[model samples]
Target chain A: MSTLNLTAKAREAATSGDYSELISLVPYAKMIGIECIKLGDELVFRLPAQDGNIGNPTLPAIHGGVIAGFMEHAAQLHLIAAMGGQHLPKIIDFSIDYLRAGLYRDTYAQCQVWRQGRRVANVAINAWQTGQAEPIATARAHFKVD
Target chain B: MSETTIRPRAERFLSVLKHCQNLGMTVEQADSQGLILRLPYSDSIVGDPETGVVHGGAITSLMDTTCGISTVCVLPEFEICPTLDLRIDYMHPAAPGKAIYGFAECYRVTPNVIFTRGVAYQDDRDNPIAHVVGTFMRMGKVTQSEALTKAVNEGRA
Candidate 1:
């Protein structure tokens, strides 16, 4: 498929709430096995428990980098879904706080766009395993949206 | 600070960690000052296939791993020090098709926390791709499972 057509399809998928299609266009998201589920206008990301993601074999915990990456990808996809644009957002910076050791289980993340200006956007993201009340990690990211 | 003792332990720890192995990160140097790790170029880790630039996530992982390894080098014994918080600033996109190196130093090690600063670069140390500052909570010694211990010993051997 041509690049223009792919971008158009991705834009359409974003507007029509076909998150899976939109995510498919992102290579890193697919590489890390990020699954998207839409609830109303909000999108949640899921990272299935995979053995390859394990960092501490003794504790059998998911890699901290995997968690951070998953959250960052979630924020980027959230922006794409919200903006309905073909342009990929460039990350300016990312700050992540690891609240707890991510266990060897499926992890979920949600993003909140705090502000979307003409040239920049800020997003806050949280990831958890069992409950949203107890997040395993939280991250804030800035993106050059132009 | 015995370089002989800490260097071998750091190597063993990195070899045992699956995520570090997955990223193909190898320790380049470990001493009292800090630790340096190298991440070779791989197409599998490219974030933007069009430009073939390495993913920001890959660089973040490398920095985090490097910082943790540096912390281990400074500690007297093996312990599980999880990242409490990490902040990364992307100075520039890494040049495509070159191995990236991450230099990390644990500047402070208190009873409960370890502070680290790291920089990722490709060709020159002055021109870094990203800069990271992080704090890790010292969670005490890891429960030495036989499997984990055996892997560390084998790595040392």
Candidate 2:
């Protein structure tokens, strides 16, 4: 019963049921809430914190796994939206950069889609504790597009 | 249980990770301010590859987990926090057949949020393979024991 279950558990929750293949084979991207986000694309997603509110003492900061999960979900959602629900893109490479510290406050990630080339899509996403201007972390991802 | 008992944190996130065995991540050290974690080579996965080396997700998970642990170490009680976002930069591929280690430091800790940075390196330790930064959100707090036991009765996301 450890507190650090977000990365893996989120993996389970997102990739559970039928997403095992994509999650297991693709080390780069992870699953989030039944959606799979390519780790390498710039994407945005929002979900209720399992804990309900913002940061508190029981768990002092944001969970790392939760962040990863969010990126994966956001990327997928962005791709789906771009495709008009036509195809699924797989994550090829992704990167993240932490810019500032965030309090366990109501948070969301707003993603910026930079470019999409044949067979690949490039994306950038920002995680904000407050808004896009106050992003604490940023992510870039590449996905294989059909 | 009180109303606050929800989304509990792992009593020993690293220790639990050790039990995973498959992920191949290890917690080398931990304290209030920071943590050191390692990713051992899996028989199927090599560290030094011609393409650069170990998988990137492995490094991300290691960095992310340690950041979460570093946040938990400073907490007075246990709360289930979620990683709002993460950023990682891969300088080069790590060498296979070697251990990869990460050093994570928490820059801030509030009741609801945590911010952190981590660097991953090969055996030399000085030369890093990747640099990582992320934010963890403590959504709510709960008793550790209760959290472990609750799995039997409830379904959570």
Candidate 3:
């Protein structure tokens, strides 16, 4: 498999954001193997199999908490990129739209910074199965960048 | 004659669901889309005093487990299936005193891929507490006989 292009510094910056800290309080993402990569204006992440968000006999069906965890991750990555600094400005709120289902195998997320402001940056993201066209979900988040 | 086959992983899963059912979790519906697991709001489970509503984590557990079951229904041979991703939107706070049910459905099913979506509602689907979508990894399953054999060796079923 080709390696995904992202810097360790950018990733570390994202993993250390306040949004990441707040949600990590829950065990959902850690259990699912969620990972994020920041590339300039773009942010990518993987939703790994196995999580506490939800349980199922088939295993492909995941819980909502897992998704929320990634959303926060992507948002923070953008915050870090926009600020070009260690500390994230702030996150006012985040929201998502559920477009479809993702198999337990693995799903990918692509996030774009729509508007970056000194104080607030708006971000939009689309998540879907690796090989499919239709997005599993779309999300937009607002954050404050110092 | 061959020895009896049993799937310890599946059996162990059932015990967990049975506990939820005993607590009044209604994971009793299945349709063409997939399994529809429900969790009803009741006083015993809703320990929070302020709203008397079911806990978010408990509801998440229901969604997670049902998503897995939805995958299991399609592939009856896998020993395990894990979650890939899940997205849930809390449209409204859960009502503490009312019996709210979360209906989970698996939408996409492949040999190694599974997808599902579900929602939480108060009896009727017209009103819902949350919208949930999930992705699962079809880990793999073992047949009943294989399960029994594994149990014989592993000492835990």
Candidate 4:
């Protein structure tokens, strides 16, 4: 457990399958304003647009690295929620494909755990701004589960 | 060749990236080989509070930005190149309390795409924290193609 203490309510939420507390524990996620929501059995990540997130002011697009980071964080959170917090996965490698420029607007990501072995897991993630029909980026990540 | 001519252009290009400024990335060196960018240590980017390790996301940003800068150095004129794909492999956790540096080189540039490879290290180049390979889609008109050809000729000269 990290030294950052979660309120009893947050702990309760975690026990009830809400992962916002677990996501909040990550310092970078906090820096970038990442939020998690549980919709039925699915977990989705959201990143609200901020002035600091813009990489190219001319296009007014979100930074490519920021979009990649957000997707990576989403994969980690999805793994945590799936594993029931038994272990924290360490990223081994990440590959991202930028399909389109991430517009300066709210971005959402959904992760699908492709495989979860005893010692490793592979996750695929897609991020979209306007709708899921067209994703801004897609990523695949491998993590070491101990 | 003159600092008076190159420095401001580089600085002006970097100023447009707000996220780069937020991460406090600075151009440490730029030459024919490539460009080296430094990312100052910041607590705001720590991924593991327990170990105080900077987040991998920040390192990715640093390398991506370095690759972009390296492309600029290789090209004759500045152009907007969006990252088409990037792959990063982490070798080890970055040491806390030390600034990370990313050195990137553009290896190949075609009419529409640029290929780059980079390494992120805290202290020793041989001992890199991460290795990154990326492709960027070169946007804008083909006028810069002549500029790139001239730059290559100058390098060989």
RMSD to the hidden true structure, all candidates:
2.3, 12.0, 11.6, 5.1
lDDT of 4 at B61: 85
* Number of clashes recorded per candidate: 0, 45, 36, 0
Which structure is stronger by DockQ: 3 or 4? 4
Best by DockQ: 1
Off by over 4 Å in 2: A1-113, A116-121, A124-139, A142-146, B1-11, B17-20, B43-52, B143-145, B149-157
Q: List, residue by residue over A3-46, the lDDT tens digit for candidate 4.
A: 55433423454568766665566688888889887888888899
Ranking by lDDT: 1, 4, 2, 3
Instruction: Give candidate 1 regions above 4 Å deviation.
Output: A1-9, B142-157
Residue by residue across B1-157, what tens digits does model 4's lDDT show? 4434344445556655789999898888877677788999988888877678888888888887888767776666666788999999999999988999999999998989999999999889999999999999888544534443333334321
Expressed as tens digits, the lDDT of each residue in B34-147 for candidate 2 is: 667777865334211223245554566667776666665566655555566667766767776678888878788876788888888886656788777777777663464354
In candidate 3, position B109 carries an lDDT of 77
lDDT of 3 by residue, B1-157 (tens): 1112223333345444323444355545554445555566554444223345454545555666666555544554434555565555666667655666666666777777678887777767767777777777654535523543344335453
Residue-level error in angstroms, candidate 4, position A71:
0.6
Q: What digit string (tens of lDDT, one per residue) describes model 3 on residues A1-146?
A: 01322233444554553234322322333434556654453556777664433333232355443454466555665566555545533344455555665556577887778998767788887778755378876777666566
Models sorted by DockQ, best on top? 1, 4, 2, 3
TM-score of 2: 0.51
TM-score of each: 0.93, 0.51, 0.45, 0.89
Selected candidate, larger DockQ, 2 vs 3: 2
Q: Write the per-residue lDDT of candidate 1 for residues A2-108, one digit (tens) a residue.
A: 35354566578687877686666556666677898888777888999988778878778888888888898889888887788565778989999999889999999
Instruction: Report chain A TM-scores, every model.
Output: 0.91, 0.62, 0.68, 0.90
Q: Which digits, one per residue and each the tens of the lDDT, describe model 2 over residues A1-146?
A: 23433234334434332333433333233312223334444333554443421122233444444454456446755665565444555556566665655456555776666898878888776777667787777778877777
